[model samples]
Target: MKNIKASMLAISLAFLFIACSGKVQTNKIPNETKYYLPKGVKTSDKVALDSKELQSYSLALEKFFKRNVKADEEKKQDIYQTGIERGYFQ
Candidate 1:
């Protein structure tokens, strides 16, 4: 029947839409590391963080730490902090 064909078409379209509407995971490190070093600087075990890399790494670490601390503060309860505050005598 035409109604059965239409229902099957609708179901197939719905599934196709759902399958295509997914987030694509990318290799973020490849992009981040592309220009991280100076030009002509070959990456190897001998490669070290230049001043720029050092500064960027420091800032990135500081931001990461701050974000984690802010998240902990926003949480209703942090068991580790709670235990440290109540169980430890200092």
Candidate 2:
């Protein structure tokens, strides 16, 4: 009885760990050709932008795409603050 209970417990933990480690992939748009990069003052994609241009583009992408214009989490990129990076929003 003791051995059976221990084996079941181990199996449960293994299953739990596997479920938690799995990453959930949501439907995401990788590329958008409909909207091209809007013209704006060229700034460091490294530094975040607080200017009107950045705000305009960011809001437009978010409002239409329903995705926050942020950097690639896995790539360690910043908004640069272009808000639009890696064609993530492109």
Q: Give per-model TM-scores.
A: 0.31, 0.31
| Residues 1-90, model 2: lDDT tens digits | 999999999999999999999998798766776765669856565866679989899899887887444644555656754567445565
Pairs with backbone N, CA or C atoms under 3 Å apart (clashes), candidate 2: 47-80, 47-81, 48-80, 48-81, 79-82
What lDDT tens digits, residue by residue, belong to model 1 across residues 1-90? 999999999999999999999768785546654566578887566756689989999999999777766677688676777778797745
As a TM-score, model 2 comes out at 0.31
Runs in model 2 lying further than 4 Å from the true structure: 29-90
Off by over 4 Å in 1: 34-90
Worst 10 residues of 2 by lDDT: 67-76
Candidate 1 is scored at a TM of: 0.31
After the best TM-score superposition of candidate 2, give how far the Cα of residue 67 lies from its true spot, in angstroms.
Answer: 42
Q: Rate the local accuracy (lDDT) of all candidates.
A: 0.81, 0.77
Candidate with maximal lDDT? 1
Global CA lDDT computed for model 2: 0.77
